[model samples]
Target chain A: MKTLKIIKIGGNIIDNEAALSSFLEVFATINSPKILIHGGGKLATQLANQLGLEVKMIDGRRITDKATLDLITMVYAGKINKNIVAELQSKNCNAIGFSGADGNTIISKKRPVKPIDFGFVGDVKKVNIETLQVLLEHKVTPVFCALTHDKKGQLLNTNADTIASELAIGFAKYYQTELYYCFEKNGVLRDVSDENSVIREITTQSYQNLIDDKVIVDGMLPKLNNCVHAIEKNVYKVCIGKPEMLYDDKANFTTITK
Target chain B: MKTLKIIKIGGNIIDNEAALSSFLEVFATINSPKILIHGGGKLATQLANQLGLEVKMIDGRRITDKATLDLITMVYAGKINKNIVAELQSKNCNAIGFSGADGNTIISKKRPVKPIDFGFVGDVKKVNIETLQVLLEHKVTPVFCALTHDKKGQLLNTNADTIASELAIGFAKYYQTELYYCFEKNGVLRDVSDENSVIREITTQSYQNLIDDKVIVDGMLPKLNNCVHAIEKNVYKVCIGKPEMLYDDKANFTTITK
Candidate 1:
C-alpha cells in the first residue's frame, strides 16, 4: 500500500504566525502523500467577544450555537484555511483547503441533544475517501478545517482530533496511513511539566494503567482514546507530539498502539 | 466539445435569502457541467461596520486594503461560499467552493498602484483549466468566491464578473463555454428606469453605438465590455440578466456578440 500521512495541528501553532510559517516550511519538505487538518484558534473566541456572542463550553468542549458556527465557518474555513493554502503554494506545496461541505468530502450528523444541546456541533458520519484519493493522486495536498455538514444545508462544528482520526482510518483501507497529532507539547509526558519526560510508546494496556495511576486524567484521556481508536482501526502508526516530529525520525514522540 | 456553463451571480440576489434559495434550486437543474461564481454581498460591509473598520470606495469599487481583504476573504470564501455549497448539496448538487487559492486553480497578481491605490486587490492572471476540468470530469461542480492570491502568499480581493469572464475564456479552449452574469436587473435596459426596455441582443458595433448614444453608460458599460471581451476571447455565448433566465428558455436576456 502507498504510504500517506495525515497530520492534525491544533490552534496553538496556528495562532502564532512565526510558528505556522516555520511549520509549513517543514510540511513542504515531507516526501510522502500528506493531508493537513487544523483547528480554529482563539481568534474565533476573540471575534465572538467583539461581536457580543457568548462562548459556551461544557467539559472543555464548545457548545456551537448558530452564531458561533457561522463565526468559525468564517474564521476557520475562510481566513485560516486560505492563508495556509496560499502560504503552502508560495512554498510550491500545491495545497488545497477544504471544509467538510466541500465536495461533501466529509458528511457528519448533528450531535444528539439528549444530555445538552450542542447546537450545531456534528459527529463524523462518513469520509468521502474517493474525493481525497483523487486529490492526492493529482498531487494536491488537502488542508481541512474542523467543520462538517449534515448534508441538509447545515454546517456543523466538529472536533479536529476526531476528524484526523476518522480520515486516517478511512484512508487506511487503501494506504499505509500514519496519523500525527501536533500540539504545543513535545509528546505525552510522564511528568506534564518536564518536557524531557516523553513517553516513547504507549499501548492500550499502558494507557489504562496510566489512567489508574492518575498520570493521564481529564483532557488527556479523550485525546489518547482517539489516538488508540485510530490505531485499532488499522492505521499503521499514530504519533502525538510537536510539529518538529514530522521531519525528525529520531524525535521522541508518543507512539500509540493497540 | 463538451459544453460548460459559467454563471456569475451578483450580491443583490445573494443577499436575499429567498432569492438565493430559489436561484440555487434552478442552478441545481443545470444539465451541463457548471461553475458558479459569487460576489461578496453587503455582509462584509455590515461586519466592517460592526468591527469599526472604515469602508473605502472609489467610484463604487471597494478599495481593498489588508483588513478589508481579510474581511471579504472570510465573508466570500468562508461563510457565503460554504453556505451556497451546502445549500446546493441539499438540492443534490455536488458543489465544491473555491477561492483562487484552492488547488491554485486561479492565480492573480496584485493590482498595481498607478492612478489610485486599491490595496490588496488582484487582477486575474491565470486560471488552471486542467484542475477545473479534472473536477468537472469527476462530476464536482465548483463554486468560486471573489478572492484570488498572488503567488507570494498574499490573498487579494478580485471582482467576480471579471473572474467569471476570465474563467469562461480559459475554459473555452477545452469546452464550448457560455458565460452568464445574473444580477437584479432583467437585462441591460434601453431606458435605465424601464424594466420592459431590456435590450435582447447587443453586438460589439451596436455596443459602441449604445455608448455613443449614452444608452450604455456608468456601471453597465464595464459589465457589457466584459461580456464583449469574453465573446472576443472565443467563449461561445455571453448573457446578462436575472437568475430565472438560467432555467427559463423563454426568458429574454441581453446576449452579447462580436
Candidate 2:
C-alpha cells in the first residue's frame, strides 16, 4: 500500500514566522502524500480582544459563540491557511487550503447543547475521502484549518488535533498512514521543563503508568490520548514532537504504539 | 464544446444576508457547470474600523498595504468564501472555496510599483484550466474569493470582476462560457436614479453610444468594460445586473456582445 502522512501543527509553530518557514521548507520535501492540519493561533484572541468580544471559556475549551466562530474562521481558515498554501507553493509543493466545508470533505455534528453547549463546536461525523483522495492522487497537498460544517450551512469550530487523527484514521483504509502531532516541545518529556528528557516510545500498556507518574499531565494528556486513539484505530504510526522529527527520527520525540 | 457559466456576486448582494441566501438558492439550481466568484463585503472595512486599522484610499481605489491585505484575506477568502461554500453545500451544490493559491489555479503578478504603487494588488497572469476542468467535470462548483498568488508565495488583492472575466476568458478556450455579474442594481440603467430604466442588450455599437451620451459612467463603466472584454475574448455571453437574472429573461439586466 502507498503511504500517507498526516501532520498537525499547533500555534507554537504557526505563530512564529521563521519557525513556520523552516517547517514548510522541510514539509515540501516529503515525497509521500501528506495532509497538513493547523490550529488557530493567538491572532484570533488578539483580534477578539481588539474588538472587545469577551471570549467565554468553560473547562478550558473555547466557547465558539457566533462571534468567536466568525473570528476563528477568518483567522484559521482564511489568513493562516492561505498563507501556508502560498508558502508551500513557493517551495514547489502544490498546497490547497480547506475549511471542512470546502468540497464537503468533512461533515460534523454540532456538540449537543445538553452537554455544556460549546456553541459552534463540532464532533466529527464523517470525512468524504473521495475529494481528499482525488487531490492527493493528483499530488496536491491539503492544508486544513480547525473548522468543520454540519452540511446544514453552519460552520463549526473543531480541534486541529482531532482533525489530524480523524483524517489519519479515515485514510488508513487505503494507505499506510502515519500521524504526527508537531508542536514546539520535545515530545512527552520525562520532566516537562527538561526538553532533553524525552520519552522515546509509548505503548498503551505504558501510557497509564506515565500518566500516574504525572509525567504527562495537563494539555499533553489529551494530545497523548489522541495519539493512542489513532493507534487503536489502525493508524500505522503516531508521533508527537517538534516538526523536525519528520526527517530526523533521532530527534527527541515520543512514538505511540498500540 | 461543453458549456460553463461563470458568475460574480458583488458586495451589494454579499453585504445583505437575505439577498445572498436568495442568490445562492438560484445559483445552486444551475444544472450546468458553473463557478461563483465573490467580492469582499463591507464586513472587512467594518472589522478594520473595529481594529483601528486605517483604510487608505488613492484616487478612489483602496491601497492594499500589508495590514489591509491581511484583513481582506480573512474576510473575503476565510469568512465570506467558506460561508458561501457551506450555504451551497446545504443547497447540494457540492461547492469548493478557493483563493487563487489553491491548486495553483490562478497565478498573478503583483502590480508593478511604478504605476502609483497599488501595494499588494495583482494583475491576473495565468489560469490553470486543468484544475478547474477537473472539478467542473466532476460536478463540483468552485466558489472563489478575489485573491491571487504570485507563485513566489505572496497573496495579492485582486478585483473580483477582473477575476470573473479572466476565468471566463481562460475557460472559453475549452468551453462556451457565459459570464454573469450579479449585484443589487438592475443592469446598465438608462437612468442611474431610475431602477426601472434597464437596458435590454448592449452591443459594441450601442455601448459607445451610451458612453458618449453619458449614460454609463463611474463604477458601471469598468464593469461594462469587463463584460465587453469577456465578450471580445470569445466568451459566449456576458450579463450584468441582479442575481435573479440567471433564470428569468423577464428580469431586468444588460447583456454585452461584440
Candidate 3:
C-alpha cells in the first residue's frame, strides 16, 4: 500500500507568492499520496479591519462573529480554495481545493463560547472519512480550508489547527496515514523563541512538561494537542517540522511519540 | 401538493440589522416549505479593499483573483453561513447553512475566461438535488452561500445570481418549487433610476426590448439571464421583488414568463 501523508501549510506560506511557488515545486515532486490543509490568518484579519469590524480573539483563537465569519468563509473556502488549486495546476500538480463543508466531509457543531457568543466558530464533531477517501482514490490531492457546516446547514469558521488535527485522525483511522505538520519554525523547540534549539523528540512525559512550563502556548498548544491525539489514535507517526525538512531523517523535526 | 419556495436575500437585506431581523420574523411565519440563499457583497468588497487587494470589477462583476477569492470564501461560506443559521435559530426556525461544496450539492467547472483569468470563478455544471431533498424532507431550510466546487475538488467563487438561478431550477425540477429573488430594488425597473417604475411582468418580448433599449445593463444582465433560464426550465414562477414584500400580493414584484 502506498503510504498516505497529510500535511498542513500555514498562512505564511500562502501569503508569500514566492514561497507558495517554491512549495508547489516541492509538492509536485513528492511521489507519495498526500493532502494539504491551509490557514488564512493575515487575510482574515485584514478583511475584518476593512469592514470596520474589530478583530476578536479568545485565548488566541479567532472569535468568529457574524460579520467576521462571513469574511472568513469567503477568504478561506472561496478565494484561498481556488487560488491554491490554480497554483498547484500551474506547477503541474493535480491538486484540488475544498472545504470541510464539501460532501459533509467535516460535520461540526457551533462553538458558542458562553458569555461571549462567537457566531460562526465551530468545533468539529464528526467527519465523513469516506468522502475524503473517494477523492484520494481518484488520484487527486485534496486541499482543504478549515471551514465546516453545522447541523443547521450553516458554514462556520473553524481553527486550521483543529481542522488539521481532526483530518489527521480521520485519515489515520481510515487510510492509516502519517500526519506531518509543516510550519515556519524549525520544529518543536525546547525554547519557544529559539529556532535552532529544536527538540529532537517529544515523549508523552516531555509533552506534559512543556505545557506545564508554559512554553507551548497559544497556536502551538493546539497543534501539540493534535499531535498527541493523532499518536493516541495509532497513527504511524506525527512529525512537526519545516516544509523542506519534512521527509529528512536528520532534519530538525520533532517526532511525537505516545 | 405542498408548494416549495427558494428565496434569495441580498447583502443589502443583511446589512441592515433591524431589517434583517424583521425579514427573518416574517420569513419564519411562512408556514410553507422554503430554502434561503444569500449574498455578502458589501462586506466582501470592503474586506478585499482593506487587504490591499484592488477590488477588481469587470462591468460590475467582481473579477475574482486568488486573494479576492480567499476573502470571499471566508466571508460567504464561513461567516455569513453561520449568521443566517443563527438568525433562523433565533426565530425557532430549523435552518442549516451550506456552501455548494458541501455534500457536493453544487458541482461546477472553472470558467476559463480568455484575456483575464478569473482565478476561482466557476459556472454551475451540476447540483446534487437528492442531498438537498433529504434536508428539506427533514424540515431543515438549507441556507446556501454562493460558493461552489469544481469536479477537480477546487472551490470556486460564483456569482450569487447564478447560484440562485441554478438552485431555483434544481429545486423547481426536483420538488416543483417557486423561485423568489428578493432584492433592495422594488423590482425590475422600466427606468433605471426610478424606484416606483417597477415592471409588473416581463415576457420574452419585453425582455428583448429592454435589452435593445440598453435598460438591462451591467449587474442586471446576469440577473435577467438567470430569470429567463429559470422560466425556460419550467419553474412555476420566478418572482423579483423587495424583501419585505415577498409575501404580499400588492408587492411591486415582476414575474418572468415565457
Query: Candidate 2, residue A231: CA error in Å?
Result: 1.2
The interface root-mean-square deviations, each candidate in sequence, come to 0.8, 0.7, 7.0
Question: In terms of DockQ, which candidate is strongest?
Answer: 2
Please tell me what DockQ candidate 3 reaches.
Answer: 0.15
Cα shift from native, residue B215, model 3 (Å): 9.5
Give per-residue CA lDDT, model 2, range B1-258, as digits (tens): 888999999898899999999999999999999999999889999989999999899898899999999999999999999999999999999998998999898899999888689899999999887877888888989999999999999999999999999999999989999999988788889988899999989998899999999998998888888888889899999998888789886788888989
Q: Write the per-residue lDDT of candidate 2 for residues A1-258, one digit (tens) a residue.
A: 999999999999889999999999999999999999999879899989988999998998778999999999899989999999999999999988998898898899999998698899999999887888888988999999999999999999988998899889899889999999999888889987899999999999899999999988989888988899899999999999999899985787889998
Q: Which digits, one per residue and each the tens of the lDDT, describe model 1 over residues B87-140?
A: 998998998888888888789998889888899988989988777788899989
| TM-scores of all candidate predictions against the true structure | 0.98, 0.97, 0.63
Clashing pairs in 1: none
What docking class should model 3 receive?
Answer: incorrect
lDDT of 3 by residue, A1-258 (tens): 458888888888878888877877787677777788888858767656666778777766567777676667666765666556655655545565556665456768887668777777778998766645654665567788878776454777777777877887877755667787878888888787688889878877889999999878877888899888888877778888888775466678888988
Q: By summed lDDT, which 10 consecutive residues of candidate 1 chain B come out lowest?
A: B59-68
Q: Model 1, stretches more than 4 Å misplaced?
A: none
TM for candidate 3 is 0.63
